[model samples]
Target: MTSSADAPRSGPVSAWAPLAIPAFRVLWFAQLGSNIGTWMQTVGAQWYLVDA
Candidate 1:
């Protein structure tokens, strides 16, 4: 059995490690902004078009 200290580390330790890379951070934020915009649009559409 491997002890916690002896275990081989795998993958990025920090959740934000992927965003540390310039290319990944750019793409991630772009996607995040797009998703936020889409969410706002959907909410606006529902508010304007749906009956109470």
Candidate 2:
């Protein structure tokens, strides 16, 4: 017998499910900001390494 997990998964073009929790929204934004800052630092470090 096939399990529910055997069903086809949605493709990337599918609309993303909404985040309903307020705490989740706040955490997601905070993590996004942190990730951007981390990426900026990484690029700066790589440039410095190449210049050295």
Q: In model 2, which regions exceed 4 Å deviation?
A: 1-17
Q: Per-residue CA lDDT of candidate 1, range 1-52, in tens? A: 7899799788769887688799999999999999999999999999988865
What's every prediction's RMSD, in angstroms?
A: 7.4, 7.7
Candidate 1 — which pairs collide?
A: none
Among the numbered candidates, top lDDT falls to 1
Q: Highest TM-score: which candidate?
A: 1
Query: With candidate 2 superimposed using the best TM-score fit, by how many Å does residue 20's alpha carbon deviate from the native?
Result: 3.4
Instruction: Please report, in order, the local distance difference test score of every candidate based on alpha carbons.
Output: 0.89, 0.82
Q: Indicate the residue-level lDDT of 28 in model 2.
A: 85
Cα lDDT of model 2 by residue, 11-30, tens digit = 66434344556888788889
